[model samples]
Target: MTYWNQEIETMDPVRLRGLQSERLVKLVHYVYEKSPFYKKLFDEKGIKPEDIKSIGDIQKLPFTYKKDLRDTYPTGMFCVKNTDLVRIHASSGTTGKPIVVGYTQNDITNWAESLARGFTSVGLGKDDILQISYGYGLFTGGLGAHYGSERIGATTIPISSGNTERQLSLMEDLNVTAVLCTPSYFSYLIEVAEKEGRSLKNNKSLRVGIFGAEPWSESLRHRIEERSGIKAYDVFGTSELSGPLFTECPEQNGMHVWADMFIVEILNPETLEPVKDGETGELVVTTLLKEALPLIRYRVGDLASIENTVCACGRTHPRLMRLTGRSDDMTIVRGINVFPGQVESVLMKIPEVSPHFLMMIERNGELDDMTVQVELNDLASDKVEDYNRLISRISHDLRTVLTLSVDVELVNPGTIPRSEGKAKRVIDKRKF
Candidate 1:
C-alpha cells in the first residue's frame, strides 16, 4: 500500500477530473501558442484553444499520430526554443526519419517523476539496488529508468544491454534487487543463467522485474515469475509518452495511469469513439505535463482497455490493461487480424515449448499462409512421432486462440535468435 505521491495517486475521481481539466486547458493554450504544429492543426480543424476548456472536449481536438511527428522531423513540432531544451531522444527511424523528442528541464523532471511513481509502486524504494539492463544512447529505456531509479534514491546500475556474462556478474555481485529491461532480454538472461549452472531462482537479492518496451502476455508473466522466483511486473509507456511511465502496483493487475499527468482515452479503432470501460480498443493519450513536446490526443497505437474503478491498492487512476500489440504490429491474414502478443500467449502456455517464437506469414496464390516457428525446451521429447504430435497440439491450440490454423515448426533450443532488447516476432513475406 506504499505510494510515491499518495495524495495525487489517491485523489478523488471528481477532483482528479477537475485537475485534469485544468491542466488540459493550460496545455491546449500552451501548445496552441507555442507549437506551430498545434496552432496550424487547431486552425485547420476550426478549433480554438478556448474550445477545449475541459477534458470532455478532448474529442473536438484533432487526433495526432506518429506520422505527424515523422512528417515534422527534428523539432518542427517543438514548443520551445533550442536553449530551453536540455536533452533529446529519438527512435531508430527504421521506416523513416527518426522521431526527435526534446526535453526541457521540467520535462526531464516530470519524466523521472512518472517513472519514480511506477518504481515505488512495485515496492522499489531508497534501500533497493536497481540494475538497468536496457540499452543506452538513443533508446529511452536506459537513461529514462536511470533518472527514475535515482529519483527514488535506489542504488542504480547503468550497465546498459548486452554482455550477458557481465550483466549476470554485476547483478549477483552488487546484489541487485530490481531489474529494468525488455521481457525478452530477461527471458534470455534466465536461459543463460540456467546454461551457466546458475539459477536466478536462487538469487536472494533480486525480487522484482519491471518489463516492457514490447507487448507480452499474462502467461509469460506467470512463466517468468515461476522460473525466476521474482515478481514480474509489466511497465507501460512509449518513447513518445516520455518512456517507462507507469507500472503495475504490487497488486500485479494493471498499470496505473497517472491522472494528473496525462488524460488517457481508449477508443474503438474503427469508430474512433471511446470504448466502454473493460473493452479493448486503441489507446489515445494527451500529455498534460510535457513541456518541450506535448502531444494532444496522440494515437499511441497500442490495443488495450482501461479499468477506471479504484484499484485494490486504493489508487484512483485508470489502469491500462494488457496490451495485445501495437496497431502497426498487427497483420491481417485471410482477413483475420493477428497480433504477436496473441501468438506469444498461445506459445507460452505450452509446457514443452520455450517462450521464444517467430511468426512467419506468406502468400501462396490468392491465399495467405501463417507458419509459427516455436523453440523446443529440454522437456520436449526427441522422438519423431512425439515431436509431430507436439506440433499438432501446438497448431490446435493456436487455432483455438487465433481462430486460424497455422503451420507449426518446432526448432531445437537456441535455434531462434535471442534478443538483448525487443524480440522480433514476425516475418511477413507477403507484398501488400
Candidate 2:
C-alpha cells in the first residue's frame, strides 16, 4: 500500500553512494546558477560550480549556517522562480528573526513522497487513520505529515495542534489509529488522559506514534509507549530541509536517512571536517535533487553520528543516530557542559513532578547559576515536605551527574508556559 520502492529503500550501500554523488553534482550546479546566495558563496571561495564533481567535493563548498539564512531573510535564498514556489514554511524565530523556507510544486511533491516513505518505513500504511497534532501554517510539521497520510491512502484528520479536548474527542470518536507530534506534547497528552481517568490502553484505534522537533531520550519513548498505547518512533528533520529527513523503522535502532535526496555526514564542529563512524559531531546535509533552496553542505547544528550497515529490519539506507542535542543549545555551568535532554532525563524520574518545566540561566556575582523551575502534579501541591524533598533530590541528582548544583523550584500547575510548536525550554537572562 506504500508508494516507495522497497528496493530503493534497501539499496546496496555501494550503489547508494554512486547515486548520491551523481545527484549532488547536478544539484550543486543548478543551485550555483539559480540561487544568488549560493552563487555569491561559491564566488567568494573561488570555487566554480563545475568544480563540484562528486559527493566528496561537497566538502569544498562553504557551509551554510542558520545565520546565513537569517541574513537572507524571507526569500533571498530561494533557487527556483517565484512562480514555481507552491508553499512556504518558517521556523519560530524565538531567539531572532525567522528563517524562511520555500517549496516549489515539485518540492512539495518530493517532500510528501519522502514523508510517505518514512511513514511506511515505520509500518504505517493504508489501514491507519493518522491524527496529526503538529501545528499547521508557517510550521512544516502538519502539512508534511498530512501529505504522507494521503499518499499512503490513509484517512488524514488534519486536526493541527492545541485544543486538547477536541484532540482527545477525535481520538476516541474517530478511532484514530496513529498520532504525530513532538515528544513533549505527547507526554503532556498522556498526563491529561490519566487526569481525566481515560485509559490509553483501552483505545483500540491508537497504535503508532511519530514524534520529533525536540530531543527526547529512550526513557521518554518508553514512558510515552507505556502511557499512550503505541509504538513511538523518532521522526527527525528541520524547517530548512523538508521535514521527515530521517525516521526510525520498526526496529528502532537509528533513523534511516534518504540517501537519494540528502547526502548526510557527521562533521567535527570545531574542525568542520568529517568525523569517523560512531563518533558524535554536527550533522551536515547536502540536498541532492532539490530544485528550490538546494543547500550544499548546510550545517544543521544538531549533534549525531553516522550509522551505515544493514538494520535488523533489512533497510540499507544509512542510519542516523538519534539526535544527541544541538551544539548551539549546550549550556556551560561551572565549567561543566549540560544539555536540556540530560536534565529532562533526571526530571522524568521523579514521580510527583509534571512534565512542564523550564531552565533559567543567569549570571550572579560574575558566576553563572541555573534554576530549574518545574511544575508538580496537582495532587502533590499541598505537601510541602514532599515538595522540598523533590527539590533536594533534583539538586543532588544534578550535582552528581553534571558536577554542578542548581536551584530547583517546584511551581504550581499551569505556571509553566505551554508550547504550541517547539517548546522554549531555556531562558538565558544573562546579558551577553
lDDT of each: 0.91, 0.83
Alpha-carbon deviation at 118 in model 1, angstroms: 1.2
**Predictions: Cα RMSD each:** 1.0, 2.0
- Candidate 2 lDDT at 423 equals 77
| TM-scores vs. true structure, each candidate | 0.98, 0.94
Instruction: Give candidate 2's whole-model lDDT.
Output: 0.83
lDDT of 2 by residue, 1-432 (tens): 232668788789889889998998888778878988888888999999788788778778888888888888878888987788888888866556789998888788878877777788777888889999998878888888888789888889999989987888889999998999988888777777777888677788899999988888776787678777799999898888886557788888788888888888898878878888889998998887767787878888889998887877777888888777887788777678888888887877776676678999999988999999988876575777877777898899867877888998888877887775677789888887
Clashes of 2: 0
Total clashing pairs for each candidate: 0, 0
Question: Best candidate per TM-score, number?
Answer: 1
lDDT, candidate 2, residue 121?
A: 75
- Score candidate 2 by TM-score against the native: 0.94
Which is the leading candidate under lDDT? 1
